[model samples]
Target: MDVDFLLNKGKTIGLEGLEVYMVETELLNLTISSDKVREVSSSKTFSIGVRGYIDKRVAGVTINDENLRVDAAFEKLSSLIKTSVEDPNWAGFPPPRKGFINVICRDNRIIHTDYAETMKTIKDLMEIMKDEAIREGAERAIVAEGMTRLGVQKITTANSEGVHVQDECTVFSTFMVLKTVTGKGESDKSFWIMNRRFDLAELESLGRDTARLSLMFGGGRKIENGEYDLILMPQAAVGIIASTLIPAFSALNILEGRSPLRGKLESKVLAEEVGVSDNPELPLEIGSRRFDDEGMPTSSKVLIKDGVLKQVLHNYYTSSRMKLENVGNGFRRNPSSPTTPYPTNFFVHPGEVKLEDLQREVKKALIVYETIGQWMSNPFNGNVKATATHALLVENGEVKGPAKGVLVTGNIYEWLGNKLNGLGRETFTSEGIVAPGVWVEKVKVATE
Candidate 1:
C-alpha cells in the first residue's frame, strides 16, 4: 500500500494527524507428539493499521483481509475517529525525531528456512533427545509433546509527522515435555528455548538438561517447613521477576495506582548490589529493536541503579501525561490495539560472585530450578507464592537430593531488598529476560 497517499487522503479529510502501520508475516510450525511428527503447517498473513486524530481525540482501525482497499479503510477510520468519545488526556502524536539507530534484528538463514529444513530440524531434535535421555539414565523418557516454530515479520510505520521507518526480524522457538517412568514412580520435565539464530548444539544441551532434571525428579522428597536461604536459578528467577517485579516499573501502572513504586523514585528499593536496565541494543537479542511501534527511537536506560529507583518505562502517552522523558517502550499487541509501554531486552546486571561460590556461601538452602503458578502472584504488594517443580536440597554446602512438592513463599520487595545475599556471574536469557542466579535469605519453604 502507498502510505504517502493514505496520509494525504486523511489530511484532505480534515484530520489533524495520521499514522499507518503494516506488518507482513510468514510462519512455519511443526508439532510432535508421542515421539513422532504429528503435524506441519505454514501461514502467510498481512495486516494494516490506521490511526487518525481529530481535534485532540484519536482512534484506530485494522484490516487483515487480502482484498483490502486502502481508500475504503481510510474512510472507515476517519468515521470511527469522528464518532469516538474524546479523551481528556489525549495528546497529539509525537513529533518527528532524528538520530535513529539501526539494530541487526533479522537472520537471512531463518527467513529462508523451508519445509525440508524444518523437518530436518525436527528429526535431529528427536534423535538428540533420545541420545541424551539414554546418557542421562532415563532411556525410557518419552517426548509427550513438542513444538517448533519459525517466523519472519516485516514491519513498517509511517506518520503524517514526517516519520517513516521499516524493519524485519526472524524468530525461532521450540519447547518439549519429556516424561520418564521408573520402577518407583513417574516423573516429567519441560524445556523451552528461543533465539534469532539457530544452533543445533544449544538444542542438544537443552535436551540433555531436561533429561537430567527428569531423571533426578525420581525418588523425590518433601522438605520440612522452616526459614531457609534460597538460590533461584535463572529460569526460576525470571519466572517471578518478569511477572511480578518488571510490571511495576511501567509508568502506566503507577498512574493507575497499581504500582508500589509510584512515589518511590530515587529511593532504595532493593539491595545495593542490584542493578536493572532495559537494553535494546544488545546484539542478537530477541527484544532488540531500532524503533518502537510508535516510530520513536529506542535506547538503553537504567531502570534501577544500585537498588535505587531510577526510572520508569514510558511511551508517548504516559510520558506526555507525566511530563517525563519517553524511553521508547511503546508497544501494541496488534494493529487495532492502543499503544502501551513495555520493556525490551529487560535484564538484571550480573554481580561478581559466581554461582558455585554463591552456593558455597550458603549453609542450608534450596536451589530452585523451575516453578509453577508464578504469574498468579500479586505484583503490586510484592507477595510471591509459587510451587517448586524441580528443586535440589542443599545442606552444609552440599546437594543432598531432589526436593519436590516444596512451596516457596516470600515478599518480592523484601527478598530483593534487605534479604538479598548475592548474584551469579553467569547470565542466562529466556523469552527476552536475561538474569543470573539470585540468592536470598530467610525464605519460607514448606511441603504445603
Candidate 2:
C-alpha cells in the first residue's frame, strides 16, 4: 500500500530505503452484568507508521491524524526524527518477505462474537454455577460482571526489500470474576479464557466450575505452616511463571537492565520438565504476528526447551547486540515502548501426566485454589509473598476441605527449580501461554 508513496518519495528525495507501514485494529467488546447488557462498544484505529533511511539518518514516525489528513502528520514525523540522537545500532529492514501465511484463515467478518451470543454464553455459564450452588446450599448466584472481547487487526509492511505483505489477525477472549455468598462466608473466583477463535462457548465449564469452587470455600478456616504439595491451575501458572519467568528470558528487557537471565543462555538453571517457546504463527494465538513490530519475521525460539535453557526471546536490536539472529518477539505494549520485546502465545509442553492423574498423584498437597499478588513478585529476584484464597486441603492426594485464610511465600525460581515435581494433565489456553498445571513439592503456608 505504501510502496507507491515510498517510491514517489524516493524520486523526489533519494534514500537508501523507504518504507511505510500501516496497522489497523478494530475492537468490539460486550460487557454484561446480571443478565443485562451494560455496554456495547466498538472502535477502530488506523496508524500510518513509517520507517525509512535518508543518508544514515534512520527516521521513524507513526501518522495518527485520524481525520484522514495524516499527510501533514507524516511530514511532521519525517521532520521530527531529524532531531533524534543518531542510533549507531540501528539497522535497515530485513530482506523482502518471500510470501505470507494467512494467519486469519477464517472469515474475519465472523470473528466478532456479539452481545447476543455472549449473553447466551453467560446464561449457560450461570446455569452451571447455579447447579453447583444447588449441590451446596446457596439459593441463587449473581454474576458481578461477565464480558467478552473480539479484536481484529490488519498489518501491512512494505519496505524497499521488495516486500509487501498484509496479514489479518483476530482474537476472542472472555473473562468472569464472581463471588459466591453464603451464611458462612463469601468467596470469590476469577477466570479468564482467551484464544484466537475459541470464545465463551469453550469456557462454559471453566466459568461454572471455578465459581462452584468459590462457593465451596465460603467458611474457610486457617491451617498450620508446613511443606505441602502445591497444585497450580493453568491460568494460575501463566500468572505465576509467565510473569516472573519472562524476565529471565527477555532479550529486550535484558538490555534494559530488567531481565534476570541476562547472561545465562543455553544454561540449565530451570527444571528439566519446564519448556517455553514463542510461535505466534501458531495455528491460533492472540499475540501471533506475521512479523514483529520492526518487520522481522517471527521464528520459533526455544527459551527453556526441556529445561536446558536453550535461548531467550529476541528482536532485531537485541539479536544484533548478542551477535545472534532475530526471533520476532518485539513487544510493544503501547506506543511508548514500540521496540520493547515480549512473548507472544508462549508454549509450555505438558508432561505425559493428565490433569486428573496429577490430582491423584498429589496425596497430601495443598491445592492453592487462588493466589494473590502474583504481579507484586520481583522478577529480578523472583521473590513473592502473597495470600491464598479458596485454598483447598488435598489430603491423601485427594482434595478435602476448601480451606481459607492461608498465605503463600516463596521465590518463583526456587519454587519452580527445586520444589516443582510433576506437570498436570490439564493445560490452560490463555493469551500468551498454553501452560499446564504444575505441582510443587513444598510451600510455606500459614493459616489464620
Candidate 3:
C-alpha cells in the first residue's frame, strides 16, 4: 500500500470546547514532455495535516511519514495558538456532510505511460503550427505542452463533538503554449500565443498568427496618450484585472488589512453586467477538485453578483471566525495547511462581441498585446509599462499594421475600469480560469 498517514495531538484550554481536525493523506504524480523530451516529472507524496482550536485561536501543522509524530505536531501547535486581532463571524463545521458528488476518477488511469501518444500528439501539433507559421511569414516556431495527473485522498476528523470525513479524487489534463518568431536582422520579432483548448493543430495556428502579428509590427509609431477606442485580448485583460483588483474576494485579506476591497462588502465593484464565479464543474482544468481540502463539497460560488460583492471564499477557521457561509475554497497544497487566500478555477464571464467586431470598432486605435517585464518595468505598482509583441496601429476600421519599440504605461485599473468600452465573445480557459478579451479607452503609448 502506498500509504501516508498523519498523527494528531491536542489539548483544549477553554470552555468553548476544544476541537482537533486531521487529514490522513493525499497522493499525486504527473509527467509532461515536449519535442519527445520529458520536461516535468515528479512522484506523489503521502502527507498529513492537523488543525487545532483552543480558546478561539486556531493552529495547524503537517507532516508526511509512516510514523507520524502526532504528538510533536501538537508540541509545535503550542506556540501557534495565538489570538487573532481581527474579529470574524463564527459559523462552525458543516452540517450533514455527504462527500463530493460526481467526482470523476478512474483506477489504473494514474499509471499512464503513454509516451508514444504524447510524442505523436505533440508532433502533429507542432507540424500544424509550423505550416501555419510559414503561411504567416515566420521562419521558425516552437511549441510545448504540459500534461498532469492528480490523485488525492483526504480525511478530516474531529474529537467526536462533530466532523469526521474523507474523500478521494483524480484528474488528467494537458496544456499547450506556442511561440512564433519572424523578421530578419535587427527587425526580428516574435508573437507569443492565443489561448485554446489542448489541441496541437490549433496550437500551430495560434503560433502562426502570433508570428504574423510580430511581422506586421514594422509600420507602427508612437501615438500620443489619450482616450481612444480600445480592444484587449483575453490575456491582457486578465493580466490587469487579476493583478490590480481581484484579490479582495478573500475574507482573510479583508480581515487582515491587506486588501483594497476592504470595507466595501455588498457594494458594487465591477461594472453592473460583470459577474464572477468559480466552477469546479469546468470540463478540464488544473483547479478542478472533488472536494475542498477540508472535506467540504465544492459547488458553484458567486463572488460578484451582477456587480455587487456577495460571498467570499472561506475555510473552517474563517467560517468559524466570521459567522458567514463557506464558498468551499479551502485548499492547502501541503498537509499542514496554513490558511492562505487564493483563487481556484477563477473566471470572468464573457460578453457577446467577437474579436473581429471589437477590432473594427477600434477605428484608429492601438491594439495592445504581449507585455514583458510587467513586474520589473512597472516598479511593483503593476502599472504595466509593456511593449506589445503584436501591437497594431489601426485606423478607419482597418489594420494599418504593427509597431515596434513602443511602450504603454499606465494604471491598469484606472485605464481599464473607467475606459472599459466592450468585451469579446470568445474566451480562453487555461490554468483553470477564463477571461474573455476586452475593449477599453484612455491609454498612454510612447516610442522608445
Compare the candidates by TM-score and give the number of the best one.
Answer: 1
lDDT of 1 by residue, 267-311 (tens): 998899999999887765778888888888988889999999999
Q: List the residue pairs that clash in candidate 2.
A: 331-341, 354-425, 355-425, 355-426, 362-397, 363-396, 363-397
Candidate 3 C-alpha error for residue 13, in Å: 13
Please state the error at residue 205 of candidate 1 in Å.
2.2
Candidate 2's displacement at residue 362, Å, is 5.5
lDDT of each: 0.83, 0.68, 0.56
How big is the positional error of residue 207 in model 3, measured in Å on the Cα after superposition?
5.7
Better of 2 and 3 by TM-score: 2
**Which has the better lDDT: candidate 1, or candidate 2?**
1
Candidate 3 RMSD to the real structure: 5.4
Full ranking by lDDT: 1, 2, 3
Which should have the higher TM-score, number 1 or number 3?
1
Best by lDDT: 1
Clashes of each: 0, 7, 11
Off by over 4 Å in 1: 66-83, 357-361
Q: Please report the TM-score between candidate 1 and the true structure.
A: 0.92
